[model samples]
Every structure is written in C-alpha cells, then in structure tokens.
Target chain A: MYRQKYLFLLPGLLVLVAIILFPLLFTIRVSFSSWDVYNPGLNWIGGENYGRLWEDARYWQALGRLTLLSVTTVLIQYVLGFALALMVWRDLAARRLFRVLFLIPMMTTPVVMSVLWRTIFHESLGPLNPILESLGIGAAPWLSSAGWAFAAVVMVEVWQWTPFMFLLLLAGLLSLPNEPYLAAKIDGAGPVRTFFSVTFPMLGAISVGAILIRLIEASKIMETVYVLTSGGPGTSTETSSYYIYIRGMRDFQIGYSAALSLTYLIIMIVALTVIAKLLVRALVKDAA
Target chain B: MLKITDLELLVGSVAHLAAINASFQPGTLTTILGRTGAGKTTLMRAIAGLIAPDRGQILLDGTGWTRLPPWKRPVAMVTQQFINYPHLNVRDNVAFPLVRAGVAKADAAARAEAALARVGLAAMVDRRPSALSGGQQQRVAIARALVKKAPVLLLDEPFVNLDYNLREAFRKDLVDLLAVETGTVVLYASTDPREALQMGDQIVLLADGRIVQSGSPRDVFANPASLTAASVVNDPPINPIPFHQNGVADFGALGQQAITLPSGAYTLGLRASDIRAGGPHQARVTLTEVTGSETLTHLSLNGLDLVMQEKSVVLRSPGDVVGVHLDLHKGLVFGADGQRAGV
Candidate 1:
C-alpha cells in the first residue's frame, strides 16, 4: 500500500515534467545542433556553438556589463529599501497613506513602468532635464551617450523594483520581537548602537534572503533595457539576456541561442550560490 | 533611593496606572505584587524611563529622572521573556551594556566574566544565546542586567517562563547574585504571591492600577488592610464569605461561628490552608490540581466555592463529594466596603 502511495503525487509530478523538465531536456539537445534561419533543420554539430561562445567578445562583454549593472542596482535598492522600510515601520504622521503610496511603483508592471520612465528620461522635452536645468545642473545626455544610457537603465530598474525590497524588509521588521529593543534601550544604547547591536543583527537572515531574491530577479535584466534603451548607445547597457534575445529572436540563430541559454542558466546557478554563501557569511555573525 | 509621586499613565481612555506614589530604599528588593494586568509592568517601566507618565515626578537621589530618556537613565531591566542578543556570545551579551556605557574593553570583558560566573554560567561564555537552553538564556539576560551594576535595577517577572524546577533554581541563583549588589534598589514584579512573600524585603500589593498595600512581608501577611490586599498576599487566594448576623458569623449551611461582633454585612476572610477534609459540611469537588507534592482542590459547599490545600498529593476528580471543615477562629473579618475590620 505504501509503495502504491507514490501514485498520489503523479499529477504534480506530471505538471513539473511537462512544463519544466521537457523544455530543459529539449534545449540541451538542441544546443548541440546547427539549426539556424538559413539551414532550418537540426544537424549534429557537437561543441561548435560552445567553442564559438567561449571566443565571442560581445557575449563576454554582455556578461560583464550584466554583472556590473545588477550588482550596482541591487545594492542601491537594498539601501534605499531598508531606509524606506524603517521610515514607515515606526510612528509616522500619515503611516497608512505613505505605506500605500510607497507600494504604487511595485504594483505597476515593470515593463510598463520602464516605458513610462523612458518618456521621463527624454533629453529636452522630458520634465527631468528641465528640472535639472532649472536647478542649475545642466543635462548633457540621457539616452544619447553610452554612460548616461547605462545610468538611465539602472535608474529605471531601481525605481521599478525597490518597492519589492521595501515590502520584504518591512515584513521582516514587523515580525521582529520588541524585547531586544527594550533591552538595548535600558542598556543605554543610542540609536546607532542599537541598530548595529540589535536591529541589524536580528535582521541578518531576512536581509540575505531578500538580497538573494533581488539578485536572481535582477540578473535577468532585459525587459527594461528592451523598452527603454534597447541595448542603446553602442551596446553599453546590453546585458546577457538581451544578447541571447538578439541571437535567438532577432538574428534567428536558434542553435547558438540555445547554447547561450543553457550556459547562462549554469552561470547564474553558480553565481547565485556563491553570492548567497558570501551574504550569509557577511551578514549573520553567529552563523559562522 | 528612588521615589515616584503622583504617577499617572493613560492607555487609550483607560488609566493603566494612576495616582501612584511609592519609594524604594537602597539595598532592598521591593516586589511589586499584582495580577497580570494590574499595572505592575507599567510602574516598573515608568521607573526605568521606558514609559512616560502623564503626570508624575520620578526623583532619584534627590535629582529628577522624569525628563531623561531610557538611554540616559542609569537603569537596567530584564523583561519576562528571555531576551538575549542572538548574534553575540554569552560573554559579549553580558558585556554589551558595559561596552555601550564606554567602559574599557578589557574591563567590560572581565566584569562580564565575573557576572557570568556569579550566575553559574562560567563554562558557557563562548556559546551563543541560541545554543543554550531557555533557562540558560534567561541567565545570560540576568548576567547582562547585573554586569551594568546600575543604581536602579528592575526585573519584571524574569523567571515567569522557565519550567518549575528551573524557575526555582534560577530564583535562588538570582537572589544570590542580587545579594552582592548592596547599593542597587531592585524592583521585582511578580504575580505569584508565594514568590513575592518569599523573595521581597518589602511588598507592594497592587489592584486596579492602585497600590492597595505596601509594607514588610511579615506585617502585610499578619494584617492585610483590605480584601484586595488579602487576595494578593495569599498563595491559593483567600475566600471571602458573607456574614450578617448578630453575635455570630453565619457561613450559610457550611457552619456558623459565635463571635463578639455587631450585626452588619461583612466578609469573613478564610485561608485555604485552614480548610481541611473530613468534616460535617459536605462539598462537591469542582476542580483538582496537583502541583509538585501538594494538592489544591476546589470545593463548592452550597453556592460558595472554597479551595482546600493539602501537604500531600490528593487525587480527587470533579463532582466528587467530600467533607470539609473551616477554622473560624483564625479567619479575618472585613467590612461591607471590603476594608479589613478586625479578627
């Protein structure tokens, strides 16, 4: 009877295989083929695409650019999210109203928000440059220069997803026990000391969890780039996902794109694992 | 010395604590005895500067402490729950206050080690609080509170969460540790009357956010000012029987006592220990609880509920009929307004 009980899990297992397992297996097989727009058929060409990806300068550049963009944006979001969470977590004049207002950005769709941000970042006609000019800070370029386009992409990503970090951190702050804070207060710890000694240490596990979740979401950073910059200003903001999209959809190199996808999945898995370990070590003191 | 005058705290529209006036002497542990919501914690928090009273003056050593924040006050407190820094080791947990107060690092470590040794936790200084048992974690909290050596120390039911055996052991350890601090005016809050009677040098009985009685334990036990005071000072709680007969205190069906008193509505306070089994009056057992080696049985004679205490375990189920006898000569008499009249 116990042996037959495994059949009870068959439905969920079938759904997993249908949606996830089959695509993965098919992609692994297709990665070794020589399928393209011109050829239009799968022909065995083992390791050729992998060898080309290894020597592809543009692919390497996109990977590096993806790393820099994600790490910078995630760190900025973490800091700003923590600050906003602390602000609304405690006593405020209009706490409920502010909390709902803070959630507005995250509630909107990211691709839609990115499109709105594109209009906002328009060089002369947009409100941002005009305000900067009024404030005595002249606007040189937004989407017209390489560095400015990169910064514009980061700005949009930060604006769209920072509320996610804020929500998680706020939930974490709400769940923390109030007793440790009382102990800190009685021990004569000022605001800074209490934060370092009690609040930050208590928030360690949740902080790491939130950061890793954001990193995973951030590493796949192509939607905003697609809507806003579209790998603009000569490939300055072209991340790994957009490079793959260009190869598979735009250039129609299905075989090579499949190879890139599998390689990118493996790289993300290793990189995220490494980052999680480092975060756990750095944030949680007693875990060591 | 610490003194509070006319302290009033309002939560919503309810008065959590009102018209409070109390004084604590140095080298004495004043146990604030009350029920769970009797404002014992609010009073302690006001003294520690964790809570603000709407109208009050807290004078410490002839200087006002009302305006100072908790971080500025020279006070240390251990709450009912076990609160220790999970990220720090046991020694660092104890040393946190000292380090925060700007003591030398080595001096703070030494004092923390000494406090840990005093609490019988010398062998576990390097372990995190999460690695210890609940009792050990509370001990770390206690050691941390002790290492500060503040002039005023407030412990709000510090051992209320521990198991029975651990609570007893930690209580003894805490008393021993506190005995060494001669200058600290300790305010210990508890709902257990036995603990309040045993550990307090002076007892403050609170009811409905007011101090019903405050005196030495022996004095309060010998002469409870009111029915509320009598209830707070009793372990199993005192039973108040209505009596309104001339020259006799009628206890309705259970028995009556011929006493020299005027005819008026009064309450007769009877201790649980004075009521015994196997007597002329029969009562149905309503509840039975076996705690340690003693038994506390609740019996209802007619409509009056009376608790009987026995030295040894007596297993009696609910609805079981049993005979009980009350010692009327040892009872106390309270007036119609609940104030103790006389014996």
Candidate 2:
C-alpha cells in the first residue's frame, strides 16, 4: 500500500522538479558565474558578485526599505483587517453582503489595481487632490514627492491586500467554537474583557498564520511600486525586487542580480522559518 | 425566587416558546425535561439572558430581568459541549470570570483553586483543556461556573457528551456538589428521563413549546398531568392502550381490576413493571430482550402490544402464551384529549 502511494506521487514529484527545482538550481549556478546577455558566456567568478553586493549602498538601502515596507504594511493590514472582520462577523444584518464587498479589492488583479491607483494618485489630474481641495486642504504631490510617493505606494498595497487578511481572519473567527463565547457571557464578562480573554487567545494560531502569510507576500511587493513610482524621485520607493529588476534587465548585470535575488530569497526563507517556528510554538503551547 | 411569567419567544416565524410560567425557588435543582426541539434550551437561554423573549418577563426577586443582558445577570451556564479556553490552563480558565469581575490576582487564584478542588480538578490545574479528557473538561467548565458564584446556574445537558460510565460518575459528583450550593437556583435540562429523576428536586415537563406539567419529580412521576408529561418522564416508554367502557373497564387481555371511572373514551398508561406476568389473562410473547439484570418481554394480545419487565433469569421466548395481569391501581387513565381524568 505504501509503495502504491509512492508510485501515485511520482507524477507530481516530476512536475515539481521540472517547475521548481530546475529553475532554483539554474539560478544558483548563474549566481556564482559572471553570466550576462551581452557577454553570452558563462565564466565562474566565485563569490565576487556576492562580495560586491555586500558593499553596494543602493542594495542595502533597498533591503532596508523592503523591511520597513513589509513591517509597516503588515501591521496596518492586520489591524484594519481584524477590525473589519469583527464588524462583519458580529453583525447579523447584511453580513454576507458586507463580507462580499470587503473582499472585492483582493479579488481584483494587483497590477490592475496598481494602475488604477496610479491615476487616482495623479499629482494634478487626480480626483483625490480635488477632493482634498474641496475639504479645505491644499493640493499636495501624492506620487511625486519622495515621502508622499512611498506613502502612496504603501497605501495602495495596504488597500489591495488588506482584504486577503480580512478573509483569512474572518474564516478563523467564524470557525471558532461558539460555546466559549457563551461561557464568557454567562461568566459576566463584558465585550472588551471577552475579546481579550476569550477571543484573542483562541485566535492565536490563526493570527500567526495570517501574519506569516501576509509578511511573505508583502516582502516581495514590487508591482505597486513599479507601476506607481518606478523607483523614481531618487529611489525613495524602490523595493528589493524592483532593484533586482533594474540591475538585471536595465543594466544587464545578470550575475549580480542573481546574487542579490538569491540573498533576498535566503532572507525571506529565514524570516518565514522563524514565523513557522513561532506558529508551532503557539500551537504546542495551546495543546499543552 | 426566579419567576418566569407568560414567556413567549418566536424564532423566525416559528413559536419557540409560548406562555411558559414557572417559579424556581432558591437552593433547589429544577430539571427541565423535553425531547429534541422541545424548546428546553430556549427556556434556559431566556433565563440566562442570552436570548430575549418576544413576550412576557423573567423576574428575579421582584426585579425584571427580561431587558438585562447576559453579562449583567448573576448567571452561569455549562453547555453540552465542554467549552474551555484551549490556550489557558485549568486555573486560568476557572479564574477568568473572577479576573473579568475585577478581583485581585491572588484572590482569584485562591478562589479558582477552591472551585477546582470542588470539582476534583485541582491536580490538573496547570494542564490545558486539550490535554484533559472530556469529563475533565466538563469539570473545568463546572468549576468555572461555580467560581462565578452566580445565583442562577443553567446547565444544558452538561454530561450529554461523555461516555456512559463517565456520565454516571459525573452525575453523582454534580449532585453532591450542588447539594451544598445553598441559595443557588440551578436549572438543568436533559432529554433523559432517568437523569431528571435522579438529579431533579423539581421537574418541569415541556412539549411543543408549552409546559405540560411542573412539580416535584416524584409527584410528576406518580401523577403526570397529561399523556405527554407521562411519556416525558417514563423510560422504556409507557404502554398506552385505548380504553373503552362496556358496562365495565376492559383493558383487552391484560385483565383490568374493578375500578369506578366516568363513561367516556379514554386511554390507559401502564409502566412495564406494573404489568404482572403469570396471571389468568393470556398474551403471546412476541419478543424477549435479555439485559444483564433484567429482561423486557414484549407481548401482544388482541391487537395491543405491551412490555413486561422480569428478572433476567426468567426463561421466555416468542410465540409462547403466558398469563399477564395489569395492576390498574398503579396505571394511569387518560381522557380522549390525553389529559389525566379524575376517577
């Protein structure tokens, strides 16, 4: 029976090797060698590309910005998403309608959403400036200024992805055993007390899982920054992925880009691994 | 006293409860007996202030409780599903109510320990609910309710999820614990008649959203007001046969004794134990079920079927004719409307 199961898995294993392992091995090979389209030659350069990457200021800046973006966006998304999920989950009226409405932003393609937001944040022609002017606020550069550009990119990203967090957290909230809430109520616990004591603790594993997933996705954020800012205004909104794109596609430095990409991949793996460990610890603690 | 007067609740165009009136005294365990979908839980939830009744009111010691929310009421509930905070240990789970009530940590811990010890769960105070057995989890739930010191405790089939042996053991422990809880009005709901008889000081029988009868368990058992109430409290089911008068009370082959009853169409309710075997009246044995300690012999006579409880050592089989005698004095007589008629 075990051998039959293994035989059944052979086709899936072959597909995984072809689609995942092959490219991963190729990327590692390319990261070690000085290979570019212009040279059309593969010359092994040991760790020179990686050594240069350590001294690269722009690369370090992009990494810092990516970290900042991931942390800030994930935090904001979690708070807003959790609040929205609580609202719809608690409301008995029009709950389904509100849930569907809240999921619309996530349903739209991210690149298309970014393009749509680009027009909305247009400095002079956008509707947002006119609305702000109507509200007695002066017109400010939304996508032109360095700080405002970064804020605008973060806003778009948060707006588009917060719904994913909402969906996940809402499902977690719904699947929670209802008896505890009733017990809390009969125990004379107020709403806030029940939330902290009963709701929050019960949602531990789900919250960690949601944060981990959102962290991984938000770390690789590129399309919104690319479409809206294109790393413009002195690289203020450039992320690691955008920087890698610039090095490989624009500068034709494939070897250096591959090394940067590999290092970024390693950082993501480590971060995700830590998050997984935390999740396991939480679940084990719950069991214990 | 907790007085429920003319309580009516509508659940999505269906009447869940209608004109339920009962007064529960302090220091008493009132068991609500009903079948599934019989609105037993609805009545308990109304008393807990978890759900609002559409009409009527619940008053505790002359104060109206219909408008109060569950959190404001001095009530605690243990549901059938043993609901424990999976992330918290037994101590914290039991102490949560005290902490929420703004008690000091040291005081809450002490009280939680006392309550856990009351439920025999003090040894497992540091273990999470997931680590404990189902019975232990329910004990934690009970301890959580007990620590709240709520005057009104609602237990909705608290031991329905446990195994038979565990249920029996926990039932005894619960009875002993509640016996000392003076001034607490506990309302327990169960579909099991034997459980109600075992745990209830007072029994309220419900059927189809209305109270069929309410009295002491022995009184309700000895003299059920209606056929529904009789069935609600009878195990192995009461054998009901249509009774007709022809110048004398005739109960088919289960021969009836002399009794003065009014001339009208009625039904007779006989408990299995009241039907005596080995008499002049004859009934063909159709089936014999042998339990460890007792045997339930199913018999049929003149198109009426009846069951008789005998010792397990008795030898009986299908298609055998046997003499049966029904002790009519121990049976109940119901009118055409299924209400117990006066003799």
- Any runs in candidate 2 off by more than 4 Å, and if so which? A1-48, A90-98, A275-288, B12-14, B241-256, B286-292, B311-320, B335-339
Question: Poorest 10 consecutive residues of model 1 chain B by lDDT?
Answer: B245-254
RMSD of each: 3.8, 3.5
Judged by DockQ cut-offs, the docking class of candidate 2 is medium
TM-score of chain B of each: 0.97, 0.91
TM-score of candidate 2 on Cα atoms, chains taken together: 0.88
Q: What is the CA-based DockQ of model 2?
A: 0.63
Which lDDT value does model 1 have at A108?
91
Candidate 2: residue pairs that collide: none
* TM-score of candidate 1 versus the correct structure, residues matched by position: 0.86
Instruction: Summarize candidate 2's per-residue lDDT along B1-343 as a digit string, tens digits.
Output: 9999999999888989998999999999999999988899999989888889999989889999899888999888998889888778899999988988899988999999999999998799998899999999999999999899888888999999999889989999999999988889999999999899999999999988999999999999999998888888887678888777656677665555555777767788889888878787788999988766788889997798888887655778899999887777678889899999764
